[model samples]
Target: MADSVAVEDPKFTLQEVLDTFKSCLSENKEVFLEHYVAGWLGLVRFMNSLGSVFSFIAKDAVNKIQILINHLNGENGAHYVTVQSMVKYELDNQLVDLTKRGSFPESGCRTLLRLHRALRWLELFLERLRTSTEESKTSVMCSEAYNESLSQHHAWIIRKAAGTAFWALPGRATFFDVMNVGTPEQVVAMLGDALPLISEVYQVTEDLYVQNNILDLP
Candidate 1:
């Protein structure tokens, strides 16, 4: 199932990857978790192209994706159709451990929240990349993005590990080249085209979580 929608293109381009995410957004404003996870899988390939430094983060993200994949492939898979549907299904059936980990340790609400928070960090980091100068530090930009978004959810050890990884990030020039999007100017233009869609998806999911009172789900 994962292979069918997976971003398996060997010659992966950042624009192509981002576009995969953009496709995840449905006209009805409900995001299918399958597509959303596949989008992250695309980003993971991009990160891997940057180098091995980001492997830790990518590995953790893969685990989260796999967990959601399990739910989508489970007996009640029909209810896991969209983010909103999954939340409503699980909540209505008392399948989620709202306040803490219980029978369902990997609740849809909590899992999606983790991905949602990381999406904000990705959006911030990409925006910084888009506007950055030749001398801009990817490490600093990445750390700042993490600090603002995902840091709160991470423990000190994981945060410290991530910080170490950020410091090893390639410079703006290398980062731009890895995107495989023509020249530097073209890369920025591609990002300009991508950011808004990503931001829209992030904001919509955020509002959904907030309205459901599961934004801070444990």
Candidate 2:
């Protein structure tokens, strides 16, 4: 999952990413790790298309996605199928470093937690984008979303760097076009459809981590 990594398709629409997110949740509320990774793969591709400025953010996300991908493709992949199952398996086996970062650096629980936090940022950012008007600024929307969500978890240096990148964001119209989802009206409609699913997936994973007391894992 390098920054130069190629996604499944070069021109995938936001709808495809939405479909992946939609599939991430099972009928019984299990969040499929594979689908979750696939959804992130699409988002990372979108981030890469934005510009080199966001490469740092995309790289961190890619690294987390790779960790989950490794666990999903590993020998014990069956136990790592769903978020709930992965949490149970990893904790039961003491495979997670719940305190400070240690041997289990690639633990699925911790890896997903990082991505889970980012997902909140995405949810907030997209909501802002959906409600934005012609005079609205994508940079401001992105900055506001980051502040409300991801900024708290990030270090001072990371936050400063990310804030600078926000100012380099495209205008609202260009942002909507990059989504490849028809017109701005369509993009807003698409967001309306996609946000709830993303929120649900985020909540399920959040609740799982909170219950396991691994929500703040190092």
Candidate 3:
């Protein structure tokens, strides 16, 4: 099911990767970074669904996630042991290389930060979508999420691209339909189940970045 959805349909593939993350949370402490973070390839294809503008942002995020996944899957060295450990290891070793590979937002910290930041948007938007009654709008939810999460520090182009996506969002029915989930009620229930895991992952990453002072780089 996942394999078919992922191929022949790029957007569905990305969402599938995100769904994989949700599935992995069942592993908790046993979660392996290689599989956890290696899903970026699918996500990049998924973002490509909206349009070209998001391609750059999605690529950046995918690039960073892949780096972590590689280090974890590699041998001959202690890879990032935890989200917290990874942050410290990268920053302390100067692996981040932010501005001119020195200032801020090194590929590592910066890209994860994007996903971290987007989590808040997802929470807000999902919460809204959850309680949404009476002709709710995906565009509004998406826009609200972007404004709250991914917009402030991003370049104008990204902000504009994000905004464009929000506006381009399909209505609720179409949106839910694309999710390939069940009825609205069923979807909401599933979201309730899935969101906390997503939020936990986000919070874990956010705290790591903030404590490491790597939140603003890129």
Candidate 4:
């Protein structure tokens, strides 16, 4: 299946985006790489809806997603089935460059690590949005979320660009309405329901990265 969102729906509802991510988590709590990438694609759509200021970040995320999709369609595609399986396959077969950069610049481990870090930022930002008041500043919330999660991985230029994008964020009420999930109450309720799944996926991937000592991959 194509990693891109379906064309049948030109606009994305927040619940639909959350469901994409939620579907990534399997019954055993393992995350499927295909579904996870799809979830990010959904998020990119959400970012696009926000406006052109966030296009740069969405572009970077789309590039990463395409790289993973290439691997998923490569000769060793079966090994790239799920996040857990891909990590094991790469580590066992010596496909990842643990300490230094090598020919495989886009190793599965490193690529997933970047997305995994961003996932935490999304989770935090969403939670903040869910609980925030009508008068809350979205730029502040977004910058705080970025600082606490994805900022460490980014350079000064990227951070500055991201800060600018955050400043372009719509008001809290507008953001909630764009979700297309009905009233503010409904949006919050949906966010509450979706957060645990996102948290579990992040924690599971984080633990896997820590255990294998590839969290700091170059």
Candidate 5:
């Protein structure tokens, strides 16, 4: 199932990735699980392209992505079509181990929360990158973004390791070039256009988790 949506083209741009996020949103505002996973897959590829320094983060994201993918392909997949439906299905079936991690390690609720949190980190980091000037340090911007978002949910060791990895990030020029989207000006414009969609997806998921009282699922 994952292979069907794998991005193999070298010409993959941030624009195409953002479009996946846009497609995730239906007219009724429900997020389609398939497109959501594809957006994250694009992001994981982007992180991998950055180099091995981000491999740990990318690997963790890949695991979560696969978990959701499996749910989408499972016999109960019909119930997992959208984020809202997945939440309702999982909670109604008591598939989620809300208070503590026990069985159902691959519950869509818990798995998506991890990705949801990571999305916040990306949202902040990209916003910082978008507004940055030529003199801005990418490492500093990344660390600051991490601290503001994902760090709160990470263990001390993971946070320490992630902080060390930030120092290895390429310069702003190289980073923008890796995006393969054109000039730095274009990168900023693309980010400006994309961040809101990312934020909306994050917010909608956040609200769902909060309303279900699963925000702090162990």
Candidate 6:
């Protein structure tokens, strides 16, 4: 049986985004792609709201995502289909800058790597959100997940910026409301359960990277 999550009153806009994510994760590959792109666009907006510092990283992320989105929905998806191919395309074109010498420091590979790294964090966070026995503070869960995953790969500046974003996170009530799940309390409980599965996915990826020594594959 499918586990059903119910929310009493959902705030339409952002909640729809999260709802879309849940739907994507649960079913619908094309929708999943769209939601992923939409979710990052929101994230970029959220980061931009912070300050100039985040603008740099967010700009890089947004650019790379736009590239991927174009490839996915464009005429060149066949060549940019896989993460590996995307990396090659970006690097070969000199679109990626491995070191931060100027505005664009993240290559498609590195940018994707950052997202890939964050994916682990998202898995952990969602799992935590899914399985919680009580209402969870999305801020806390987000920070905790980052510490274990994305934050490690980030430099000092990014860690500080990401931490700031975590603190700026909406509370459980708003977070769940945005998620369109039934009731904040119920959603928290669900997150607690979901977190472990997400962690498992993160761990598996982490292990694979460590084994291949491809931590910097981008």
Model 5 misplacement above 4 A = 1-9
lDDT of 1 by residue, 1-218 (tens): 55223434579888877887788778899988888887887888787777788778888787788788888888888988789899999889888788877798788778878889999999999999899998899999999999998999999999999999998898888888778899998988898999999999899899888888887777
Show the colliding residue pairs in model 1: none
Report RMSD (Å) for each prediction in the order shown: 1.8, 2.1, 4.5, 1.7, 1.4, 8.0
The runs of at least 3 residues in candidate 6 whose Cα sits more than 4 Å from the true structure, single-residue gaps closed, are 1-60, 73-75, 84-107, 133-136, 185-213
How far in Å is the alpha carbon of 155 misplaced in model 5?
A: 0.6
RMSD of 3: 4.5
lDDT (10s digit) by residue, model 2, range 51-146: 899898888888888878878888999998899999999999999998899999999989898999999999999899888899999999999999
Model 3 per-residue lDDT tens digits across residues 1-218: 12112213533632466576665443454333444464445545555664565666666666666555555645512545445555666767777766554554434456566666766776778788877875988888778777876688778987877687567667888766666667888778777776786677766666657767777675
Q: On a 0 to 100 scale, what is the lDDT of residue 26 in model 6? A: 26
What are the clashing pairs of model 2?
none
Worst 10 residues of 1 by lDDT: 1-10
Instruction: Tell me the lDDT of candidate 2.
Output: 0.89
Q: List the residue pairs that clash in candidate 4.
A: none
Task: Mark the regions of model 4 whose C-alpha exceeds 4 Å error after superposition.
Answer: 3-9
The TM-scores of all predictions, comma-separated, are 0.94, 0.96, 0.75, 0.95, 0.96, 0.58
lDDT of each: 0.85, 0.89, 0.62, 0.87, 0.89, 0.56
Expressed as tens digits, the lDDT of each residue in 1-218 for candidate 4 is 57443423476787887888888878887889988988887888878888888888888888888889888988888999899999999999899998899977889889989999999998999899889888889899999999998999889999998998898999988888878899989999999999998998899999989999988898
Stronger candidate by lDDT (1 vs 5): 5
User: Cα deviation in Å at residue 215, candidate 5?
Assistant: 0.6
Better of 2 and 4 by lDDT: 2
Count clashing residue pairs in model 6. Answer: 29
